[model samples]
Target: MSGGLARCSGSPDRDPGLQPERTRLAWRRTTLAVTVASVLAVRTALHGRAGSGELPAVACAILAWLGFVVVAHQRIRALSTPRPPLLTHRAALLTAICAALVAACGAALVG
Candidate 1:
């Protein structure tokens, strides 16, 4: 156990906090959201409405997914670097920004 991986020395039947799982789920959720937006954008574009609201929605979704990817990579790096808190904070901030971007896109679509 001298390398750098986080230890799971207690019991194998316990929850163990699930930090890695949460990070993976975050990535999955973001990716799904982006995919949905991309599909919608393509559909709208095919209908001759590319720059109305679908573009913004697609851009925001892609940006959010990219943020999630960054968070996932950071979490993996933290597994061997002892930098959990920093990665967690960055991920949270990125999520918040993505949420705001989504909201803004919604508002623009409304008006």
Candidate 2:
């Protein structure tokens, strides 16, 4: 019990604070939002008569969804350890970029 895993008392129960569970739930929510946006973008693109003009927006949405999936995977993996690592700045930046892209796509579809 001298290693990193020893941080816990082996009670077979999660911490009372439930930090890891909360973090994982938050990540799932984010992924769900991105997925919904991507689906909306694809639906809009399909309904429009712009042909290939809307493809870029759809592509951006797809990429954003994929990016979120990657982030979530990393987050879950990190949470599996006895001592969870802090969220990476790079992941935050990527999430922001993806959100912006999705917003822009929605705006473009509107106007």
Candidate 3:
């Protein structure tokens, strides 16, 4: 009766530990925290009277959030599966870049 690989059979990975759910929740929390910081950056840029410099900083902050959202959304979706695939190098790189952008914008705004 056995045929093909277990993955190909579309069997849901039995995970009694609920680790996947925990990971998904952690991702959601991280997204929320980053979003809050981004909003604060925008607020500072708009209200600080930084003039033209504000535009680029605000733009970068928003762009970073968007990039992070794309990656986080993908991860979140993957976590929904019973047996999610391993995170790829591309995804990790993009995530780091996005986070760096957000942090840079935050620092620039604060200073």
Q: Cα-based RMSD of the predictions, in order? A: 6.0, 5.1, 6.6
Report the lDDT tens digits of candidate 1 across residue range 72-93: 5565555433224445666678
> What TM-score does each of the candidates earn?
0.46, 0.80, 0.82
lDDT, model 2: 0.75
lDDT tens per residue, model 3, 1-111: 122233324655646666666687788898898799789888888788556567888899999999989998999778666677888899889878888898898788778
RMSD versus native structure for model 1: 6.0
Ranking by lDDT: 3, 2, 1
Task: Write down the TM-score for model 3.
Answer: 0.82
Every candidate's lDDT = 0.54, 0.75, 0.78
Report the C-alpha lDDT of model 2 over 11-100, residue by residue, as the tens digit: 466476767666767887888888898898888888877765687778878887788789777887677555578888998898888888
Query: Higher-lDDT candidate among 2 and 3?
Result: 3
Off by over 4 Å in 3: 1-12
TM-score of 1: 0.46
lDDT-best of 1 and 2: 2
Model 1 / residue 7 / CA error / Å: 9.4
The candidates, ranked best first by TM-score, are 3, 2, 1
